[model samples]
Target: MDYEAGTYQKLPIKQYPARELGETAEGRYWRRFLSPATAKQAGAVNYLEFCPVRPYNLAVTSSTRVLVYDGATRSLHRTINRFKDKAYSASWRADGKLLVAGGQDGIVQLFDVGSRSLLRQFKAHKRPVHVARFDPGRMHVLSGGDDATVRWWDVSEGKQVSRWEGHSDYVRAAAVNPAAHGTWATGGYDHVCKVWDARSAQSVLSVDHGAPIEAVAFFPSGSVLVTAGGTQVRVWDLFGGGRELACLSNHQKTVTCVTVSPNAGPDSSAAPRLLTGALDGHLKASVREGVYELERFQVTHIQKYPGPILSLGLSGDAGLLAVGLADGTLTVRKHAKPRADPAKAGILVGRRSRRAPALTAATYRYFIRGQSSKAAAKDSVIAAERKAALATHDKFLRKFRYRDALDAALSTRRAEVVASVVEELAARGGLSSALSSRDAAGLGPLLDHMRRNINDPRHAPQLAALAHRLLDVYGGSEALTGMLPALTLLLERVELELRAQDGLTRVQGMLGPLLAASVGAC
Candidate 1:
């Protein structure tokens, strides 16, 4: 009967603890920065803007100079140092041929990007001009100043088009709506953000951001607005009477700038992502693709910088990320290309060609070149004769060696494996034989394992029975006197577990009537 195979109760699988975190596809995508390119400036970097066309040359504003950098190589392409005072916002036109920027001299200057020559200059503000941007039509430019006023300028005419004086404090940030031809937004030190239309004399919409507004931007659709101030970044619904949508407060200091990815529009396949820079020297990216809920507004990725970040810009194709720091340093990181798997890539000999010959099917060359790795077909039939290798204890159990099987399982130092072996031995009426061992060294490990797992409800019944059998077999054995201490400890543990179970049973009995009454009321 011992040699005959008997049923072994299936036990829950034990999971091994992982030593490291698993990286997800999205995590790898955002963490693709290679070695960064650094450049020293004469003063704190104030703004960074990327060209709207191919190559996407970056315009970096620092001191009185606006330096243009090659987008691909991140090398200095040209520098425009015509400003009499510190330059502020430097923006690019849609054609990429024209650039505009404001300065502390209270003047807005337009320049030819290729010639690095000033084309037009508009001096209308009484105080320092801090914010300037091109309108969507490319025919107009907007400028805001420390005098608490926003002004519109005609690029070709070289004159002020319209001026709006509404904010009670300095206007520091502005954004042109890409969807609406005349709609734009501005934020300032008075904690107010207002949206305006070029055709209207007054602002079309307004909202209180609850803190000094540092940055304002509109989604591509022009129906949503994003404002960063204090340590919070808030999203608002423009068409819903400026109803608040989501408020993200992940930064520890004042947020300095906020920008939307170029591909984050209604027509693009990628979800809308917001990138924000803060005085805490952190850059955070947040996604707004799922249901609009307060809890869903969470930061997905974070990048740290050495100094407080003042401005951030992503290229038109979202291939380059450039950051301006308060310490007069410019850091540019390019999107790393995904590496192709060497094992799956086809083996092409010599120079690469677009018109390469296709390989034939079912040949040895084709199978060796990654064709065998293709997924199996759903309709294909699978063989059923594959056998799994048995463990050390499993081999002993198959040979009707109960005591040896118990010893092999105990040697594994795994609670689940040991419990399974003991359950199998007891089912075959071999528990007494397996537990009839002599000497302290042989019995100490088994006693320790039982003592540790005796309180676990999953293996309690089997371990409790095994413990009782062990005591009955060795209760009067005088030769094993060295094991008295171990036996005493095991007995004390068993007694503690019994008392705990009794206390729980008594508590359950006392609460039975109360539970019944509550259920009846429900």
Candidate 2:
């Protein structure tokens, strides 16, 4: 259970179900949708969540700080700060007015959307808080941390309610079923996700992933639960008291996170919609029903990010998304129109700068007028907002519109977000080497994504050798060439993380191309 500290030896990973894709009616439906999306230049994304209150909008991710984008306007509204030490995992509260994030410091912080102020910060856990969620009614926030603790906090009072302890190691995940109250789930290093009564601290169920359970979610009806692990998705009919209903497989890497489709609602289709993010940087969606549809299991698309994804949060409107990466890039994303003319695209490539944080005005007032009157209560609150904004640093991170900023970055190949990611990787002892030595055994989704990309001569070449390595180790590719540009940039952005190291470097060996390639590795 003490895996991070080496109390437990590394286990050989096995990505299972061993299914490629077989077409059916569902497969055709997916391909139809995918084709349109791809035609619109909408690539696969890493993380997605619908806003808790609003159904139409969402929060989507790229590789850098969160974005707040409007689905209708397709324009970014704001950005959340890139937490300096680590990526910030988020969940909107039931009201959709507040967003909570568990960041590197093992602290759970609250952001007030109306005022754009970091409302609170609490030492929520001993180790990093990997996952966090707010109670359905907005009275509480639940967080699972590396300390192997599941915590419930009184959101209104800003006080800790109780801490539940059962797992012997880091608690990797936690979730609240929207259709139920006081019922939640937590998973972690112990290789199981425990469903518990949030109020009573009573364990209701524990399901095995045969390895660590990375992520979990509930269907809109709360009748089924979806879990991600070992490249497959296991669906349990909670309606039948946690009976295993179906095991879905198609990915080629360790499944890192899962979420129900934004369309999950009472009147929605009986077929559940599922989305996934993984180590290979591919984001996929599937429609699961009575029987698993193989073609639907096929990855819808790929959103390229360098390194394993750390966390995901969808906006309330279902129009925006927030994705956090181990490399320190937290990206927010959404749908947008592409340039009609490539030559003129350069004019508005980078995001048009936004108005400075309103707090700057407050700071100016505080310096000039507030200093004249310490008795003014408004000055105190304004000063706090200024401090929080300053601590937040990047405009992209300060605004809640993180997804919009990411879209802007993607539009222009903006360098700031990638630069931040590289710095984090460097500090973490060079992520490339860690990835190389990971022993890709059991990474089916990753291999699947990669192998598919390799077959494309435009971006990726040398399919045979890469495919062989992939099958022999990870067994398939979960990524593709579409995301290569972003992945490459993500790696470069964070390469500075290794800058301070003493000649420790990354080593990647690949030939120019395969014999089948007519073009040079162009």
Cα lDDT, model 1, residue 473: 85
Alpha-carbon lDDT of model 1:
0.83
Residue 120 in candidate 2, Cα distance off native in Å: 1.9
Tell me model 2's lDDT, rounded to 2 decimals: 0.56
**Deviating ranges (above 4 Å) for candidate 1:** 1-21, 264-270, 289-295, 340-384, 397-522
Best by lDDT: 1
| C-alpha lDDT of residue 36 in model 2 | 12
lDDT of 2 by residue, 280-399 (tens): 766666665334332224344455666566456544323344555545454555533222653355454447733445555557654565456456555545334222222211333234
TM value for model 1: 0.75
Clashing pairs in 1: none
Sequence-dependent TM-score of model 2: 0.50
Choose the strongest candidate by TM-score: 1
